[model samples]
Structure formats: structure tokens, C-alpha cells
Target: MIVVLIGYMASGKSTLGRILAKKLNYDFLDLDDYIEEKEQLLVSDIFKSKGEIYFRKVETLYLKMLLENNTKLVLSLGGGTPCYSDNMNFIRNTVKAKSIYLKASIPTLVSRLKTEKSKRPLIAHLETDELLTEFIGKHLFERSQFYNLSEVTITTDNKTEEAIIEELVLKLF
Candidate 1:
């Protein structure tokens, strides 16, 4: 009963994963947080200190480690997790894991990410809403090839958190 939530940034993977894990009484693991704990560095710090290639490798390694060692868990992946290093392929083929994509429109993402930009390394340099919007649109477009492979795709636009969770529970159960 391992559930993996995937999406672009600010798509509610972490927020929804926490509540879903609680409702199901499963262990909740956010891979970025897990990596921070394991490496003793924030994800952004890892990217800054070691570079994205290194971060991606370590992320892939840690992702596989978590999937192999855990069960009855709800996992929230980093926004870029699926887009990197055959990770999507591994997630899709893993036994006992159900992958769900939290789909959000570029506008929805732009709105959410605008205020949270400083906390996100990838878009931290983006200074304008226009720039952020463009980046999200392009990024999501490229990532959709991978994200669309999810076992379930839930559109999060205009949906309440509880409503989204209810839909997820219905689809999952």
C-alpha cells in the first residue's frame, strides 16, 4: 500500500499527502525532506553546493532506497522527481506502489508559486509573474510527457483540498 504523489511545484503533493496519510494511518514520507535528513543539507543547498547533476543522482539513489525499504507508506516526491533519470519508469513498475499525478494548470501553479518562489530553488531567480508563468508553462509542458504516465491523474484546478482528497480516496480505494 505504497502511494506516491507526483506533480509540478505547488501542486499540493506534500499538503495532500500529509492528510491522506493521516486518514489512512500510513507512514508519510516526503522524499525531499528525507534527503535533507539523510544528507544533512537542504535540497537547494545540495543543488547549490554539488550542482543539479549530483543532486539528481543522489535524489534517484535515495528515491530508490525509500521505495525498496518502505511499505504501507504515502510518499510525496519533489516536483522534478518524475522528470529525472528514469525515475518515472521505476515508479510505474514498482510493485505495491500507486502513482498519482496532481495536475494543475499553469495559471494555478503561477498563482501558488508566486509567493513561495524564494523557498523553491528552481524558480528563485524568476523575478516577475510573467517570467514565472513562462517558466512554469514551459517546464510543465516538458514534464507532462513523464507526468502523464501516472497511474492516476487528478486535476487540482479550483478544487478544495478536501474535495481533492475525497477524489483521491475514491480513486485509490
Candidate 2:
């Protein structure tokens, strides 16, 4: 079985996914990391050089390849992964992957991301809180439909990673 974690930036998808995979004895793959490995480039570099269109195409390709491998894995996707091209349907239909969206309010997201701004490619350059809020708002709006398509949705506002994963494991397994 494959579990796919989806959500907005700083929503704890990767951290919770790693913990869930460890407890469940499943392989863990962060989609961005996989793409970086496959392309021999950082995600930031990919965005700078190839543009989001190209990066997304590569993302789709990697996702299909991962599904074909058919291993028990937990995949943590980029914030925008599900919003593009048949990606959401591909995960749901082809792999029959359990999709989970870790939802968070804009305030929570902005607060969490403030500390890690240097690590995120998309939001790193936005210096002001207002700019960050606007960016997240646009992205959340664009991707909400796909995010909402998940079989399970967990709100992460003020919740600990351990608690979120515990709840997720119960619902998914």
C-alpha cells in the first residue's frame, strides 16, 4: 500500500510522513527529494532553470515510475503536486494510494513558515508577511479542490506531529 501526504506549505506533511512510515515499516519518499535525485538538481534549481511547467512534468513522470515499483511506501508530495495535470487522479486511481491532506489555517502556516523561510523555494523570496500571506492564499485557493479530494483530511492547527500521525495511522490502516 502507498500513502500519499498532501497539503499546503509548512503543514507538516514530510515530518508526519516520515514518522508514519517508520512506525508502519513502510519506505518513505518525499516527492521533491525523489525528483531532485532523479534530475540531479535541487528543486530550487529546477524551478529556476526549467520553470514550474517542466518541473511538474518531471514530477508526474516520477510519480508514475514510483507507482510502477509497487512497494509499500509513504510519499510526501510538494504543496502543488495534486493541483496539476491528472496527478491527483493518477495517485487515487492508478496506485489506489490513500491520500491525506494536512490542513492548516493561513495564520498557522505563516507562523510555521516564518522560521523555515530559507528552506522553501517558493516562499523564501517573499520578504514580508503580507506578501507571504498573499502567495499562500493564491496557492491555497488554486489547490483546495485537489487537496479536498483526499480520502482523509487532518487539520494541523496547534496539533503535534505525533498526534496527527496517530490519528492518520488509525484512519489509513
Candidate 3:
């Protein structure tokens, strides 16, 4: 099975996915990291040098390649991956693929993304917590529709990674 983890920035898709993959003994692949490795450019650099449209197109290509070619895999996608290129539908329709939305409240997301903004390309330019919170609020609202299409939704606010993983495993099996 291909387990695809989707959510907004700092919602723990990649972090939880690594542990989930370890526990399930599945091959773990982070789409952004995969893109960096394959394209030889940092995700942020891709955005700056080529633009978001180019990045999204490449992201969709690699998403299709990974889902089509792998099984027993845990795939963690970028925050905007589902919102672009009909990627969520592709993930949902893929054979043996299960999409899990790691849902986090806006406050929880803002708190997490505050510390993580430097690493994330999208919110890095927001200079204040208020701006960050506003961005997250609006971005989450826009992307929630795509994210809600997931086969499973796991709320992650104030939850330990182990607890989230436990819930994920139960729901997945």
C-alpha cells in the first residue's frame, strides 16, 4: 500500500510519516526531498529560481511517478501539493494508495510554523507572528477542501507523535 500523508505546513506530515513508515516497515519518501534529490535544487531555490508554477508541475510529475511505481511506501507531500494540479484526485484514485490528512488547528499551526518558517518557502517572508497567523488562516481555509478529500483525517493538535501514530496505525489497518 502507498500511504500518502497530506497537510498544511508544520502539520507534521513529514515528521509523523517518518515514524509511521518505520513502524510499518515501509519505504519512506518525502516528496520535497525527492524533488531536491532528483532536480538538484532546494525546494526554496526551485521556487525562487523557477517559480511556484514550475515547482508544482515538477511536484505533480514526481508524485505520479512515486505513486505509480511504489508500494508499501509512506509518502509525505508538501503543504500545497494537494491544492495544485489535481494531485489529490490522483492520489485518491491510485490503486493501493491511502491519503491521510494530518489536521491541525490554525493556532497550533501558527505556533508550529513560527519556529519553522525559516525552513518553509511559502511563509518565510512573513515578518511577524500576526502575519504568519493570518497567512496560515487564509491558506488553510483555501486548502482545506483539497485536504479534506483524504481517506482519513487525523487531528494532531496538542497530541504526542506516538499518540498520533497509534491513531494512524489503527485507522490505517
lDDT of 2 by residue, 55-145 (tens): 9999999988887686689999999899888999988886558889999999999998987888987788999999998888888898999
The digit string of per-residue lDDT tens for model 3 on 53-86 reads 9999999999999999999999999989999999
Stretches of candidate 2 exceeding 4 Å from the true structure:
none
Q: lDDT: which is higher, 2 or 3?
A: 3
Question: Candidate 3: which stretches are off by over 4 Å?
Answer: none
Q: Which residue pairs clash in candidate 2?
A: none
The pairs that clash in candidate 3 are none
Q: What is the TM-score of each candidate against the true structure?
A: 0.97, 0.94, 0.97
User: What local lDDT does model 1 show for residue 73?
Assistant: 94
RMSD of each: 0.8, 1.2, 0.9
Candidate 3 has its poorest 10 consecutive residues by lDDT at 115-124
> How far off is residue 115 in model 3, in Å?
1.6
